[model samples]
Target: MSDKKNENGISRREFLTKGALGSFLVAMGGATVGGFALPKPTVSPGPSRRYKLGDPGKFPVGTAMKMDKENIFLFRDVEGFYAITAVCTHLGCIVVRVDDGFACPCHGSRFAPDGHVVEGPAPRGLLWLEVSRTPDGGVMVDADVEVDLGTKLVV
Candidate 1:
């Protein structure tokens, strides 16, 4: 037997070096690619809560305004001040104000200004939220509470 008589006529040193290099390359590739295979963890939102919606004086009487951050529409009609959820009753999508009333972009759900369902698809009217004036000189919108559509905050 002779060293030159090794398998495929390759020396043991060359065989071992090539094997080690291939193993190292595979290990590096796995280390870099395997991390993204698992899905990332997500944090769920907390319970529905109330939030301050700013001063009531900001809105002029007889006008309706949308508070995008609060997801509510502040209305100050001749009757009184009230708040309606901007979230559509049909599919929880935010509704936008149209010439007649609110329109849901996710679906063709239409609601009257008073939140009454005016067209098909939407099963019910928009939600009326509890609105109140805080002693801290701000308007508070209680998301956890649902009030009647006729309810108003006489701010």
Candidate 2:
């Protein structure tokens, strides 16, 4: 056991190891413990759970969809690919998708279709939720990440 006191003479909070563990989470490959805000899906993922919101058909090319319902934004560019995420690089406000791109309603931070920071009170871009197409052809996004700034999804 180890005890390190803070400047207040109170025991400091335990520090969980950080680093590579933040890059990629083993998708549904391990049992997650508690003490997290956005816990696991309340129900088992079924056909309906494939997409957090309604059908992908609702989103067409060049349309930006805000899943504020899920604290995420889904942007469909002319390329037919969509981007999704919640973690804001600024003060962590869930951004809303607008005409050309995304803008944080919190502090007026704007982002492009590819998650590039166009304007700020925000220091950088939002976190990208690595998404894939399910067997049903719906998008599956993972939002368990905590980003300060400069987060991107390569896939």
The lDDT leader among the candidates is: 1
**Candidate 1, 20-41: lDDT as tens digits:** 9999999999977777655544
**Distance from true location, Cα of 138 in model 1, Å:** 2.8
Candidate 2 per-residue C-alpha lDDT over 1-155 given as tens digits, one digit per residue, 9 for 90 to 100: 34676766555334333333443464323434343435756777644323443455666666666666566666665555454575568898877767777778888889886677899877766666645556665656555543333343222
Off by over 4 Å in 1: 1-48
Model 2: residues with Cα > 4 Å off, grouped in runs: 1-58, 98-100, 145-155
Q: What would the TM-scores of all predictions be?
A: 0.65, 0.48
Q: Which ten residues in a row are the worst by lDDT in model 2?
A: 146-155
